[model samples]
Target: MEWLAPLAETGVARALIAAPTLYLLVNAAHIMGIGVLYGSILALDLRILGLNRSVPLHVIAGFLSRMAAAGAGLAILTGLCLFSVRPVEYAGNAAFLAKLALVAVGLAHALVLHRGIGWRRATTDGHASAALRLSALASIIIWTSAIVAGRWIGFL
Candidate 1:
């Protein structure tokens, strides 16, 4: 954990930690990124769960996936910047650890869904298997948990 102290004292971290307004702005950006990411994810998952039957699955997945990716990129960049400001504290925070674990699970679920037959069926036939539906449900749960854990980090 002490190793992270050096990182927290780096130039970028020093600037961020020195400027409270800058830190707030970055935190705001991170929140916006989370909103975009979760919004796209919820929309896509809802479609898969039969909420928007009129829209084609491929259409929904195509654009939303890209948006989600962009949001994820932004979130990750800002999150890292924020982490750099207090690396040792975050590294040891229980809520941060839980959030990181949930993020991994969410990403793994997305990978499996994209690479498996569920994606194909959903795109081609506009229908998904029960397993796919379960995956969608799990996505909602996992992502929501991650968000919750992230919020909990502040209290911890």
Candidate 2:
């Protein structure tokens, strides 16, 4: 609580609070980042789940993964800026906590999947094994849940 007040009083937070236009733009950027992240991940997960088999998995996977990474980076960076504006309030929000947990799990899942041999095999062979497909399905669910929780934050 003590630290959160300081965070909300930081230069970035003070500037955003003073400039409504800047805050709005930052919010828009955050939304766009989430859209890109979810969209690319959805496409890649679907491809792994037997959709768009006509396209090569290696190519699609590589491109979509990069796009997802970029989007995640942008989303995270902007998300922190937004959070800094009302750190104490947001910290107490259940929806915000849920969203954070979901995102953490999603990132952990991605790291494990990407670092494991299955990802390499699927990318090289252009074929996703049953386990990989299951992981893809899990990825879809986890990311969707995270997005939903994020939306829920506004209502709460």
Candidate 3:
């Protein structure tokens, strides 16, 4: 906090403080993006876990993947702008650092491992695979952790 306070007194934070509404808008966009992404990811996970077997995993995964991808793109774009608001504050914050780490791991899982291995394995027979189940479990942990860390940033 001491270090962050000084960092926020710098040029970038000064600018953000001067234009608070801009920061708020950027944060709003980021939140919206995360909401959509989470919605899709959670739905797919729930389906994979057989929470809704009637929906057909393939269709649910397809739809959710599309929505998640779109939301992920929006999140990345908005996150950049939000970071500009107080780069030093974020860089110095423990909760922020944890959030970034979780996001990095989660995005990596989604883009590479999940898409290449987990998803393909699951969708090959138009049915869910064990990999999909494992992935869903991991995804939930990662996203939930990210959310908790992000929330802690405000309190801290």
Candidate 4:
């Protein structure tokens, strides 16, 4: 926690604090990133869970997955910049901690599922196994929880 103090003193943090509009822009960017991430993941997960049977899973999966990844990358980048503004406070905030943990778990779960044979098979043949469906369900839950926790941070 002591080491995090320097983050608040960094140039980025100073700039954010000095420029109100810059902070607003960064915050807006972060929101966009989150929107993209959640929207893409929701669509992909719903598809895997048997929504819109007319569409091929593999086709949408690739595009949505890539979109999700891009969103996540943008979110992470902007989030770090935002976090730098008050690193120590955020580090101590329970809701922030929970959000971070949930995000980590979600990412880990996605990685494991993507690396497994089930993901490969599903993406290859457009058929989701029971395990894949279950994973998709879990993903929905995890990501939703993470977003909730993120919102809770300000209240806490």
Candidate 5:
């Protein structure tokens, strides 16, 4: 923390601390990105939970996955930018650390599902197994937890 603080304290940190309003604006942008990202992820996960059981799984996957990919991309880009502005503080933030871990898990799940046999079979059958359903439930839980953790980073 000491190492990083000094580096930032000399560079962009000065500009950032000087313009406190930028902090609020960037936070707002970060939130909007997260909302879009999580909203799309939840939509896809809920669809897999049979919320729209009648729709072909691949069609739903194909459509919503694209939405999620775009939103997730934006979220990640913004998140990285935000992190750069406060790396030292974030490194010491337990909630931020937890949020980062949750995001890693979520990304791994998305990648695995996108590439693996289960999702492929489920898509072809238009029916996912109970395990897949459980995974969808887990996604919702992890994502919700991540959002709460991210918000709590400021407080704790």
Candidate 6:
């Protein structure tokens, strides 16, 4: 935690704190990143759940996965900068802790989904199995919950 204090004093952090408009812009970017990331994930999850049967699973998953990854990368970078502004307070915030935990779970779920045979089967078979649909449902719940928890950080 002591080491994190230096992060707040860094050049970028100092500039962000000094310039309210800059912080707002970064925060806006974070929101946009979240929208892209979660929106792509939700679309893919819906496809897995049999929403758009006409589209190929791999085609949608391949493109949306890249979009989600890019969004996540941008969100992570901006989020770290934002956190550096009030590291000590954020570390102690219950909502922040919950958000972090949810984020970790969401990432783990994605890892498992991508590595599992169910994903492969769903992509190749042109139809989702019960298990794949269940996974998609779980994905939707997990990602939505994570987003809710992230928003809660501001209130709590």
Query: Which candidate tops lDDT?
Result: 4
Considering only N, C-alpha and C atoms within 3 Å, which residue pairs clash in candidate 1?
none
Candidate 1 weakest ten by summed lDDT: 120-129
Candidates in order, TM-scores: namely 0.95, 0.98, 0.82, 0.98, 0.84, 0.93
Worst lDDT run of 10 residues, candidate 5, spans 7-16
lDDT by residue (tens digit), candidate 2, 8-68: 8889999999999999999999999999999999999999999979999988888899999
**Model 2 RMSD vs true structure:** 0.8
Off by over 4 Å in 3: 1-18
The lDDT for every candidate, in the order shown, is 0.89, 0.94, 0.79, 0.95, 0.79, 0.87
What would the per-residue lDDT of candidate 6 be over residues 76-142, giving only the tens digit for each residue? 8999989989888888888888888887888898889889888877666666778888988998998
Clashing pairs in 2: none
Q: Which candidate comes out best when scored by TM-score?
A: 4
Order of all candidates by TM-score, from best down to worst?
Answer: 4, 2, 1, 6, 5, 3
Cα lDDT tens digits, model 4, 44-137, are 9999999998999988898999999999999999999999999999999999999999999999998999899988988999999999999999
Off by over 4 Å in 1: none
Tens digit of lDDT per residue, candidate 3, span 1-156?
445446556565566678878778778989999999888888888888889677767666677888998888898887766665666777888998999999999998887755476577566545666776787898999988998998899877
Residue 154's lDDT within candidate 4 is 100
- Per-residue lDDT, model 3, residue 84, is 59
Q: Return the clash pairs for model 6, or none.
A: none
Candidate 5 residue lDDT tens string, 1-156: 767666465545566567778766766777787887788878878888889777777777777777777877777876765676778989899999999999898889888877877788777777788888888898899889988988899899
The local distance difference test score of model 5 is 0.79
